[model samples]
Target: MHTLIASPFLDDHLLLRPGSTQGLRIGERRFKELAAANSPCPPWLVDAVGRRWPDLQLAGRRVDEVVLVRQASPFGYGRASYELNLGCNYDCEHCYLALKKFDGLPWPDRKRLLHVMRDAGVLWLQLTGGEPLIDKLFPDVYRLAYELGMMISVSSNGSRLPNRSILDLLTTLRPYRLTISVYGATAESYDSLTRRPGSFAKFQRGLLAAHEAGLPLNLNLIVTQHNAHEHDAMIDMADRLGLPHHVFSNMSPTIYGGAESLPAQSREYLRKRKPFTGCNAGHTFFHVDPHGQASICKVGRDPQIPLLAEGVDGLARLRSIADKLLLRQGGCTGCGLQGTCGTCMPLVTLYRKANAPLASYCQHGPDRRDQQRR
Candidate 1:
């Protein structure tokens, strides 16, 4: 009797007897041959049957039934984001964390956490960071996840890919995707945003190197007032490289509840009209900080629950929170500007507590008010 195990990530089905590690990949013809006993049995198969079904030779003994079990996948939620580390090489001015200290989980604990996630049916993993590639354990962690049958995506700064060793490792692992942040199209504009002279050249070189290596790569254009003017050029650069790019203009306040680090124009940009629909954070997606603290998302990093301690049960608790959080509350519920409001409850709860001006995140800007006047 043979059991079949199927993998979503693999095209082949593995055929095995009960309690046997040795297996064969079989399609329709091989499966029928095995069932009908029409083909000669291989030595390995004979040995496996003998060892695993030793009791079957006894009188009145019958072959055990072959059981097939399909791999479990996450229910509705198929993706997860993990902040591999909080340490970064670049110190961008609009950084929400403001270059805070790196406090990632230890290597052993991180491995265990991945196991837990796999068991919970999370097959798609996003490994992000202050810059995931900068961490020394990145390669080992990535390999482990890949071996565990997870589709891995990386968020990086593109600074390290220029190195031959790193590029080779990336090419070998073949991550599902790599999203690199592009600050600017030129060295001066890019380095100025990163606050590291010559870093822009390193990024460009790394991007080109990755391209040459044939690794799947995408660009994330982080637009701040300082480099907003270079948006067109940045897109053109990605086009020239034949890579897809996404532009993000909204900037969050500092993680420490301060807006002091954001550029003036970035601060103003957040006040403009925006769609105010609630996010899908705790439901289909969640964020795990470097310290293994799980939250709804990066922007809504409050009420963090310890992920390793609670595991999937903690995710359930977060789902409850998300169910109750999908609406504008308090002053936002009845406000006439609700349609144009960009700020959500979580953002308001975090940033407004510091008494930072609400106007910075409100939709009642001068243009909106003037439109109302007319």
Candidate 2:
């Protein structure tokens, strides 16, 4: 049976059924109105949220199931997350990767990575980092990913998009999606968060170039104190560019890594919902550290659970480990939003280091009583 769930950020609903995952259609205007009127209960306004699903309902309340599930492997993608790199260039106020000490990936690790991805039967390989473009082997990495028959995607900051060489390379490789993080529509707001002047203009130029290059583009906006109010503007920019807008609710104080030495953000006094239940990490995706050890998403990086080694049975081994984690609660014990929450590994580790009792940042801390009461 398929189930429809509300996405934390997007206005449209995400249909999660047995062996399939898809996003339902809902226009921007309708999305905004529903989100605003719905307020705190993010899932409620969008409809299908909170509604129990049967084991076999199709379409209608169930919605469309475009993604096909592999019967032999079953999970969305046979192997969950295939982490490409860990380096990024931007110094945003809410950079979890940097804080977690997820330094960018190195070129020397290519052959090893190729072996891992191939053995895992990974359906989707997400190349992430401080900024994957910074990796000298960017082009080769894309080619290698494609050669392995893995659908490739990259998350970039767009600052380096001005490089024609990289743009040209992207044209041929044609990544499945190029998700660019746009801090703001204007120079002031954009540069303020990134702390890089003229970044906004660079991002705009990059958008145009990507479109010209025929690369699929998606815009991601991190909702922070400096730019949350500009949600409408961000949406407008996406509309103008004809791209999907991804708005992440800023929830952390600082990133992980020794950078714990850095300062924290002024958190918006919003109601923190109950931590989601269910072991989404292994059940959904597996986060890999640069050393080739697999953990439940990134949080496993902190606990240091080696689900798989960089060898023959790597993928299947990882799945078995994930299955173990899912069958029995590994870390997440009790809290709000248990089964319905998503977390970034770096942020969760950072919070855990700061407050040993609470390691998972996404599942950590107490909910704001006032916000919940309302």
Candidate 3:
């Protein structure tokens, strides 16, 4: 297995260690020079290899053996996320994907799509789904992406982490991070929130097994009415496991403009989000759904680039789409508080499309009140 990767990330070049967060930015000229050489790498890189990876030998090794160098790409895409399939085992009312369907591109098309992502200059890729591990082709998809030299991260509910095949595959390939969502600290709350009996048991077993395997892990505490009482207990759970955790209190509408998940919101935990400071969604990165539809981001899905139908050439028009979508228009017309808006325009647009109450996402929502009145 390669210990390091020297790849072009968007406009910049990066040297990253697989299965870990270690990374070093390399100058363009130095990277070009390294790529030109055949064997017996430079002193600084060799020394870095020694210090960075003490376990590996530092003999007459070629740069290719220690570091996999990627050629420069004309397209500027540093990262991307691919939803393998929308199928999931748990029925969480809080899920953003209200209509979770179990369908995706066939094996050939899936392989083609992965290649498209690899060719698009995606260095860091996220393999997501309604639940990625549950997908029948997950292992194959993951292995392909890993072999293509993309540092990967996965977002899952931790239900399948205990499966021996899944565990062994992960242990071997080793994703950079596994971000698991925790529904509740207790079985009752957990199963109730997921609406699936014995789900909490599977979740617990998976967590313990993954932890024991010494895999890098992250926890997302999904705060909802059913699980709110155990919020502190959830934090304690993460702490006890010695894993980093984040709390997601607010719920958003489904990608298809459904309000089913809005009822699961824990109003007490909802707080004003930070101001949107612009993003490089389409320019620097993009999102691809299971069927190979490319968009600027998950929130902005209109006018998608059908990667399979249009192929990689379709990406030539993505940056322009991103520019148009980023503009705060339509329902946001004549809005004065654009500067202090909490959510991005695309997300705000979804709420509008769903015909959801303005208070759910807007800064001037019903929740905001005068301090004197309180």
Worst ten-residue run, lDDT, model 2?
Answer: 1-10
- lDDT by residue (308-358, candidate 2, tens digit) is 343534444454555554432334444344454454334444555555334
| Superposed Cα deviation of residue 156, candidate 1 (Å) | 1.0
TM-score of each: 0.75, 0.64, 0.95
Q: Point out the worst 10-residue segment of candidate 1 by lDDT.
A: 58-67
Model 3 pairs in collision:
none
Tell me model 2's lDDT, rounded to 2 decimals: 0.55
Error of 1 at 66 (Å): 21
Per-residue lDDT for 89-173 in model 3, tens only?
9999988887899998899999999999888889889999999999999999999988888999999999999999999998888
Model 1: per-residue Cα lDDT over 1-374, one tens digit each: 22322232223334543223344555555444444443345444445545655642322222223323235445345567888888899988877776657777889888888876666555568998888988888888887776665667889999999887778777776777888999888888888888899999889788889888888888998888877788889889889988999887777677667775545345433536467776677877777888888787776776788878887667777887765565677656656667667777777765665456666667575666676677
Cα lDDT of model 1 overall?
Answer: 0.70
Error of 3 at 251 (Å): 0.7
Clashing pairs in 1: none
Worst 10 residues of 3 by lDDT: 365-374
Give the whole-model CA lDDT for all candidates, comma-separated. Answer: 0.70, 0.55, 0.87
Best by TM-score: 3
